[model samples]
Target: MISAEPFVSGKYLIDGNWVDAKDKTTVINPANINEVVGHVALCSEQDVQNAIESSERAYHSWKRTPLEERAECMRAAAEELKKIIEENVSLYVRENGKVLVEAKKDLLRCVDIMLQGADEIFEWSKAESLQGPQKVIVRKRPRGVAAIIMPWNSPLILTFKRVVPAILTGNTVVVKPATNCPLALMAFLHVVESHFPPGVINVVTGSGAMIGDVLCTDPRVRTVAFVGSTETGKDIIRKSASTVKKIYMELGGNDPAIILDDAILDEKAITRLRMGILKAAGQVCSAIKRIYVHESRYEEVVGKLTKEFQHIYVGNGIQPDSMMGPLNNKNQFDYVTGLIQHAKDSGANVKTVGIKLDPDTWDQGYFMLPSIVTGVNQQSEIVRAEQFGPVIPILPFKTIEEVVEMANDTEYGLRASVWTENEDLAILLADQLDAGAVFHNNHTIFQDLHLDFPGAKESGLSRETRHCGMEYFSDSYGFAN
Candidate 1:
């Protein structure tokens, strides 16, 4: 068992003070389920009400604060977070079961996003004036209190991605981190809370099912920002309909990567594909879930991928040479394992790769080696569902037209990528993809802040990042003369 020096204290941040909830929930380390990382408060409905009321009371004053001053506070928070990145990275790995490298990337991305929000707020806050038959002025106003509901997969980044933008844009925020991995993010927020005024930022910890409806349906909360599964997003939309609140959802995605007949099967190309599937143990919203390779190169591509997967090292996050870590919780572990079994039972060619570094701890943890499933039916559960684990399905295609149709077959359209040496063909196939973001010769990952990162179709209801995101947190008012 790992040392317990960095145990997380179970407390909620309400009105700039650490307070306890009615009950507490223990957090387990996915790398070793026998290990207890810490505990978090399981807030009650009354606690949610208190948080919302506190945010409502602070919204007017915070929205009136100068944008320049708010930006300054954000910059200070970002710098303070940088100072604690190393410490938080260890906390992240222990709580979330991601390797050190992935944990570090998440920390860096959080800092980058905080700074980006500071810059974007200035651009998004600019007003517009026009003089013609009538003179008019339009300005943006904060949408009262914001409810930010985050997922566990990328807790730090997703939490801050909404929190930073909401507060910077003059909206007071109440954050709800996923119950499974709330410790790291709550600890990170503790460091930055001092930078903002009392009640400007608050976190409520508990079962989302118990308190999520309270946050969404509350009339005082003008904006609801969420990042999670598509089903949950739909429920939020339905609940928010009563109050008609502005909702920004970044839901689940089953992203696909296509390899053309003329695509290069070189090391770099294969590594890119491998990283797309293996990153965070494939527990990412935009991780490449499906791969459609031309029939001519399908066998060769699978061989290359299998060879690369053999070198992956799976173990506890703190292990020096470990490359991948266990799934974040038991539900996901069972879900992915069941999908793999179903595929095998259906005659799909399922192959497991990589070795479990600690066989003794395998059953004690939610660990699974990387797996590749080929010859899967297009309509199979493995193909239609989001595995959200370290398993990928590679399907063969005959023609560009057929592959394009297969790629766009799902209800999700979050992200897709095309691989080919021919620039003309790459662009041609990219344009045909139904996803919001398309990449050429690369897999989908975080995009630049300047680009819009919204999901199309059932993938999501709205967008995040850039000016588009800011619009979701503010309203426009017009003055005419």
Candidate 2:
């Protein structure tokens, strides 16, 4: 690890240069509050405006660049990214507080997205000749400037999914990094922005309240891409009305997992289920939020699942054996704690497990053990709300019909999963789920990338995009560079 110097992103990148800011935001290590992982420059409203203006100017020239030339530059950057992936993984662990394994995977995914995105976008965005009643020459055109607002969890991958497609299509972007996790992405972007032309890629760091409106409402930005809460997404939608921007949003999900009567509950299946809930300390938007098992197998399922989760090691991500780290921030930590408390108050049986790596200093970090709750009412906060923490509630379902209804009863529908040995039955049941992505055996696995749907009707045009290529949509093509 690079211990000699802690990562610092003290300048906002605007017009291809790192410009210093008067105010700054210090990123704290969620595993160790005393450690200042990094500091990001907090830009003002004027700074955001400058970024948008620069992106607008860049779009004019960038759109004229050859498609092959644009693809070539992005491919080279993807190669260079391989060199820094490990270093950024370490930095991500320190600043973001996810396990080292997940940190590496998240950073590595960024490189793949770029490399594959280049080819996919290249093919998709090229000019097309077609006959529809009469011969037509069709070419995709760039949408001018795009505003990409990201979240802290999976920072690099989340930001790049939008960034690569936007830039490859010749739309310049002003990126807003999450307040607590900007360090790694800023560093990653620093490497990438240099590969592109000046003003093509810009970044601004600050609270959404201070600068987000400017990014979303500005007419210069033709599209607004955001990944955050439903409430925030709605707020952006309201603001974008004046400008009528093309908005792409990936919001919250209380994804459900149904354990069929014939579902496999072997060691491997149980481990996968545990990771589904505990991964990123359950900060994932589409992670399994609630589980419904056949009433006959409810006790057995809880016994086996808790046994696996209880063995997971919770500690600082930098450690060798730390399987999972603390939640990324205090607000998230507090909100999760409140969720557990409320569930308990409502007569939910919460089984807290996991051995703290450092029991003597447990309070030093924003750590919470895996909480497996039972007896939770369908309407309780823990059951209904998206408890984005390492806490999951297991409910008993007597019939498939009843469970399907219970699973469909939610405002959030990012993704869901059904675990069963019955293949035909699984596919039939999956068709009935209201969730965008319904998996028979798994969800969020790399193999399941093609199975995911972009978004449910309730959630806006949001995709749980991990390892998704820019050519994800068969009919959709980019603006030819």
What C-alpha lDDT does candidate 2 achieve relative to the native structure? 0.83
Q: How far in Å is the alpha carbon of 293 misplaced in model 2?
A: 0.6
lDDT of 1 by residue, 400-437 (tens): 99999999999998889999999998888878888888
- Cα RMSDs, all models: 1.6, 2.9
Across 301-372, the per-residue lDDT of candidate 2 in tens digits comes to 999998998898899888879988999999999999999998888888899999898788779899889989
lDDT of 1 at 211: 76
TM-score of structure candidate 2: 0.94
Worst 10 residues of 2 by lDDT: 472-481
